[model samples]
Target: MNRSARRDGTPDRGRGNPARSASDKRATDKRATDKRATGKKDAPGAGRSGGAPKKPHRGQANTAAVATNKRGKPKQAKPQRQQVEANPTISNAKPARHQYVQSAGPVKLAAGEGMRLQKVLAQAGVASRRAAEELIEQGRVEVDGHIVVEQGLRVDPENAVVRVDGVRVVVKKDLVHIALNKPRGWQSTMSDDLGRPCIGDIVSERVSAGQRLFHVGRLDADTEGLILLTNDGDLAHRLMHPSFEVPKTYLATVNGVVERGLGKTLKAGVELEDGPAKVDAFTLLDVNGKQSLVKVVLHEGRKHIVRRLLEAVGHPVKRLVRTDIGPVALGDGRPGTLRVIGPGEVGALYKAVGL
Candidate 1:
């Protein structure tokens, strides 16, 4: 047995082999010294015990850096970025180029020329200013028969025939108009000195406090019908004036059957105590043995004008109910019912009065 052999009979290779040349040994030793100086890594599994893999050398260059090209695509010749110095006093700094951009809307009106449409609507109790603008934009508003679809349009409140959703809106804020079914017992007056039922009682119930309202025309205590009430003094005067000739309709239940010629006789003209009175139109609605129902239309606001005309024709009125005045109607309203006149009806009234 050789003394260099191990217990398994394998010879150790650490000592120089007798078959290797001295020059080869010297070359191998030079390689080991170069590896140590350059910090080169050993092959994997080299110098490892228990079949474990070898670890990377600590001083070796990073694998990624070694793989990367040393001279990458020559650095791009980039333009140097201009660095702007921020103004320390920002408030005093002016912008480079100032732009004055006007937002889109209706053209501005000259001062004192006219009022805004929405403002006029709000003042007239139609709707809020914002809501009125929405209405105008929706093409629901009109001025002088032209549908306006923009905001900030200036309009003459007195002259512009402005309508919202096809209903004319009177731009007068301080005015109000109402129609009431005047019951038979109620007098057509603001108040009764005798404490009898008068218009004030109905006004107090319907109108807000502090508003001064009066009937456009008078109705007798025994007469039941539609009566216009308003705070507009000029409108009331025109409505009651005989010049405008705003027609009024009345339903009269009279004594005795009315003959066919009664309407023609009333239309032709009837002699009255105050002078001659005539009906614009007339109709005999229903006739019974004891009572007759007649419909009469007249523009006269004289006291007992309908009664006088009917009596002159040999038919006395038993019950007189005025059904309409101008464009307004009683519309199945019970006695003592007060209704607020809508803008459309008010517009009709204005037309009837040359306003």
Candidate 2:
């Protein structure tokens, strides 16, 4: 209630507390010191006022220096590229080596040195040259224990071992030549698809093992008589070739009597569907009032040529029999029989065909 007391009856501390004022002054000073220290530590370039901008820290200084250098000076020239040589032999680079190398091409042989693979097979009596090629491609032929599929491979026949169908083949100096009197209802081929009779059934009994023989030409089922079977492929090929003009003789019995001058007419030529057919020679063997037997010799190997010729001339063939081919004859041998041809006969056939 004196000069220091207010109308609300509270005493004023501003005139009464010395210790409190001193405590406030110390706290204010400590706060000011802490603020100055924090400002000094946090502010950049605080200790280097009025001087050149302080250098950055070691890592930052290096980065700034690099950037300034890049902007201030021209870039140094890059190292010159080295020249590379293309040739491996001339350059230091080595050519790549291969573990395995392929052959450049097929092998070649000298003339008259080695025989062809097909020819060797034919000489061995395995088959004809064409059939031999097929056998080779079928992997049925081998030389010296290696399968041979490619044709034209020359081999030393005397030294190189050959096999067909797992059977060894020996080179034969004397080839086999056979003449078969193929009977009616017999097939000239070695096998028949219809299970009928085959010429192989008869010849297989006479030939040795691993020796295969084939007919030189085919005759129909109803046809009978001379059919040459041989292992001489060259001779057969030459005989069968139309260019050789090897003559074949046939005897035909016709249903009707052949008119006079029919022999001459056939020799001259006859019109056929395929082409003109002609006989090299013709002769009337026998004739009756109703039927006639005629002999025809032709060089062309046409299907049913003799019968077709007679049919065109108003005569249907009753029976047909091939009597001769080239110099080989059926002879008096009974039907369904075969005989080994003499060497002289084979030589004659070879000569006839210009082998």
Candidate 3:
């Protein structure tokens, strides 16, 4: 051995490298620890040390510290699993809310419920809701035969007798729907300011103004036929909305023979000054070499739409008559005719318009 390579009887300096250094340090520490333990054990009478006793590792561990007897089994605890039934009271509880749909009847009302007398009158079929309100304002509506103009007056439904225009109201208990054959020069309006003839004037004396009559839509004062009059506001609203697209059929007489392209123009939808307009159906009613009559139906009720439509296609409407709206049709009733609409007819009218 070279003298420079030997130190303390060792032939060479210890191994060098990460693994060898770590392993050598561990073996050295374990040997030093074992010597300390042996020193303590050799002197059983050694004084209490500042630190704890040396622990026995895997080689000298006490078997009884953590083990069962090798040849015998220890008793195990049995788990208690209790079975419980579901609660019947929670399952049987009633729902908190209920739904209410519109019903045709004398709706039971309470005092101070905020329901108005005219609304009750209208719903009871004494008149159109609008007409009923008008009658109430006119002081024609009476609660228990006393004229009441106070709109906010809430009357007890079961205890009140409502009369309009001196006529006892017998709420028809049915929706009233009528299709009037509107004559030339008669307007489709509840009340006319110019005092010219209106569709109401044409209603029979039996179906008086107090009956809550009203026009469902607008018609030029000169336009004629198949005008709808009804007391069902919901049905009217549905028929008027664009979602329903309720079609109205009309027969128009024009000045000259209209080209087929005119019908096409109407069908394709014309952009009017008001807005875009649509025609669901159109056909030539009659065509003479000089004059022509055409039929057009639309889901929209634009202002003077029939006239505007004919003008868009280069033909001015010399005359116009609404032949149908939804399911109601104008048959052979004379120009000035009027009649009461039956309950079935009203239901059919509502059904036709998809109420």
Candidate 4:
């Protein structure tokens, strides 16, 4: 083998050239310096090393004592994270709180000092006492610009400002009385749930707007006659009371011929399902042997009183119509017609009811 050839059959250039030998030595030294400067151990399988790198100790990873500066000095302990003390005066440390307070109770009233709100409203013809209470509860009734929801609240009727739904309520002193010649098949109520024709249909248009008119007494759907309509609840109530004895007169056409003494029998008393019903007067108007027209007067306002009384006497009434209630007569007003009750009739009604 030649001197330039190695035993492994490779060229021995580094041994043959001094300059190449010096260059290889300097390259190795530079790599060693670089590794030491980076403070990292030589990698495995790198720079003639052929083993896996050693792992760092478990606890030494997080310890500040294991960490060092470039000069091999331990890093100054991260200025020890200072503890903060909370200042109570600072709003961020403790949030501001709100204090709550309770509301005041209702005001008390003296005895008879002010009229009850419901009574005033009812007397003003707004509604019944129960309905007025509902209005107050619904926050619809207000007095002097304040909404009143409490029951039994009273205010001066004449002096205090009362309103319903922002409309000032004025208590009407001048009472209105209307007499209607109600037609058959017309309900006595202002409204009917079954959509039947009601007396209000004929009388409501004639009366002033916002006037709440109620029938003084109810009449059956079949009966057509003089029925009183008024907003005067007190007068109506008194007229309807049993103690007042406001008489009602009716003309009934019966199926049988009434003999003489039948009037006396009816005047005496007729035993009814409710109680013994008595008529003030009963008169036979006309008898044609086939059917008879009879006039009956009674103070009781029982339902179907005239029909029931005649039926109990074996004479079933074929047609019944009320002609008079107290002194208010049906006059010449036709069926489904209404007329204003004159002052004379109104006075007589009030006198009859003792109102």
Off by over 4 Å in 1: 1-115, 118-150, 154-168, 205-208
**On residues 1-355, what C-alpha lDDT tens digit does candidate 2 reach at each position?**
4876677888755455767667767866775688788863423443233535577765564443354444676455579988876775676656678555544433335777789989987866668999999998998977766788888888877567676776566555546788889999888789778888999888776555766688887898889999988777877898888899999999998988777799888988999999999999988889877999989899988888888898998999889999999888888999987787754566567568654
> So what's the TM-score on candidate 1?
0.60
**Off by more than 4 A, model 3:** 1-174, 204-209, 342-344
| Higher-ranked by lDDT: 2 or 4 | 4
Residue 46 lDDT in model 4? 56
Compute the lDDT of residue 163 as modeled in candidate 3. 59
Cα-based TM-score, every candidate: 0.60, 0.52, 0.51, 0.51
Each candidate: RMSD to true structure? 23.0, 23.4, 19.3, 22.4
lDDT of 2: 0.79
Clashing pairs in 3: 127-211, 127-212, 128-212
Error of 2 at 15 (Å): 99
Q: For candidate 3, lDDT tens digit of each residue in 25-82?
A: 7876775687788863423322224334456676884543455456655434568888
Instruction: Give Cα distance to truth, residue 43, candidate 1, Å.
Output: 99
> Measured by C-alpha RMSD in angstroms, how accurate is candidate 1?
23.0
Give the local distance difference test score of model 1: 0.81
Ranking of all predicted structures according to TM-score, beginning with the best and ending with the worst: 1, 2, 4, 3
Model 4, stretches more than 4 Å misplaced? 1-174, 206-208
Across 1-355, the per-residue lDDT of candidate 1 in tens digits comes to: 6766677878754443555445556766886898899999665564434546655579875554335445753344569998977887666557679686654534446767889888998877788999989988888888877777877888877667777776667886667788888899888888889999988798895456677788888899999989988988878889989989899999999999788887888888888888998999998889888899988999998889888888888888899999988888887788888788877788778778876
